[model samples]
Target: MAQRLLLRRFVSVTLRGSSGPVGSRSSARLPRLSSLSWHGTGPPSHHRAGPTAARGFCVSHASGGIFNVQDQADFTDRVINNEKPVLVDFHATWCAPCRVLGPRLEKMVAKQQGKIVMAKVDIDDHTDLALEYKVTVVPTVIAVKDGDIVDRFVGVKSEDDLEVFIKKLI
Candidate 1:
């Protein structure tokens, strides 16, 4: 029964954004058509933050163009008001798919060569951000251009799809 409810919630959230505990804070903007791929039926099993670079809470593999968002202030300054389009990745350190998606996103952003910037936000550490962005799931990638959300995708996406998403943003 719990699994069924979870599936239902996930479907609703994926299809039409829903209000959660945060009440009026969820985004009204819908996910991009290209961003609608579903990789799983429900949330994956959680894992603990490890000391290794690969499994650490802080992603170290990020290059110059990619960075970890520290706070709402930083997000406002770097993302919302930035000249370049920013890809804000709302993820959790414990989420398995987030781990898989982070590096792939970094690789794709690095290829842009500063044409775009990738901001990594650990949802656990920044619950306020998660709520503000209406991120009910891990690995929610939002494309922001000139202080507005232009597109977004939830869950793990393929490299080709990600590339196309980035290209559309640019």
Candidate 2:
């Protein structure tokens, strides 16, 4: 119950644009908190938060195809040496475009059903790998097969364009 109240207060202050600190008891006019339903306790079932609300941050690599490249050695072992063609997604957590394209790439890669895999490399974490690939911008995807770059692209591509790109690799 206490958690729900705190969440409500936080949301109220945030949505209301209160100038005071988040915990401050300001008298700003807060918008309706009806949209937020915690633990299936508030409003109708339709208005309740989804399962993701409780899980917090989770990156599921159970697909066996989508994985993160930890470092240069990990990259060489998993991406460069893998049996399947790997979509080396050069990205960073701070990159706005990378965030947008990451999920799209994951979705398209998932559709392949293990035919191909995605190797996500955070440019900030692995600077050497980024430099080796000559990645100056975020969200650069390289299709690599047998340790050779087959094709590559920079920035976000439309769903249709992504699909076409992935299909061409296979």
Candidate 3:
């Protein structure tokens, strides 16, 4: 099946940290964990100006204190198994709303001060995980706790509204 092949390619790209074309317009690749060089404050290396972000695809470092989930394993540990409820942000690089929501989430989560963890998943690089989560659009926000889905929404939301939603999860 086409889906099966895509899944296989996803595995190759994700686990092996290699780029593979899974029959998609964007030949998106997963940047290896050791291949990043962080600067002050901006998008990650894989997300910089290029066909990657232009195609709404990008991968970030999981070590930069941001929840850059690269695979299902990372999702299990950083989200499902987390002591605190995790907010999963399924996003794309070319998506303007996704760009806005990313920074807003960081600021708001910082205010929570450990009460909440925000996980960012680039749908392009992690299509399998995105499909598992049933994300239909960019900027899809899902709240998870105890390894279960709780609440979710799509598009950009005001920081105040977002704070209120996160507070309830706490």
lDDT agreement of model 2 with the native: 0.73
Order by lDDT, highest first:
2, 1, 3
Give per-model TM-scores. Answer: 0.65, 0.65, 0.64
For residues 1-170, write the lDDT of model 1, one tens digit per residue. 23533553454454343433111234224332212222233222231111211223344344557888878898899889899999999986548999899989988999999999988887755778888889987889999999999999999999999999999999
Over the stretch 1-170, how does candidate 2's per-residue lDDT look in tens digits? Answer: 23544675576445445444322345233324534423223334223232223311225399889988766888999988988899999986657898899999999999998999999987655778888999988889999998899999999999999999999888
**What CA RMSD would you report for each candidate?**
13.6, 10.4, 9.5
> On a 0 to 1 TM-score scale, where does candidate 3 land against the true structure?
0.64
Best lDDT among the predictions, by candidate number: 2
TM-score of 1: 0.65
RMSD of 2: 10.4
Q: Evaluate all candidate structures by whole-model CA lDDT and list the values in order.
A: 0.71, 0.73, 0.68
Scanning candidate 3 in windows of ten residues, the lowest lDDT window is 31-40
Which model, 1 or 2, shows the larger lDDT? 2
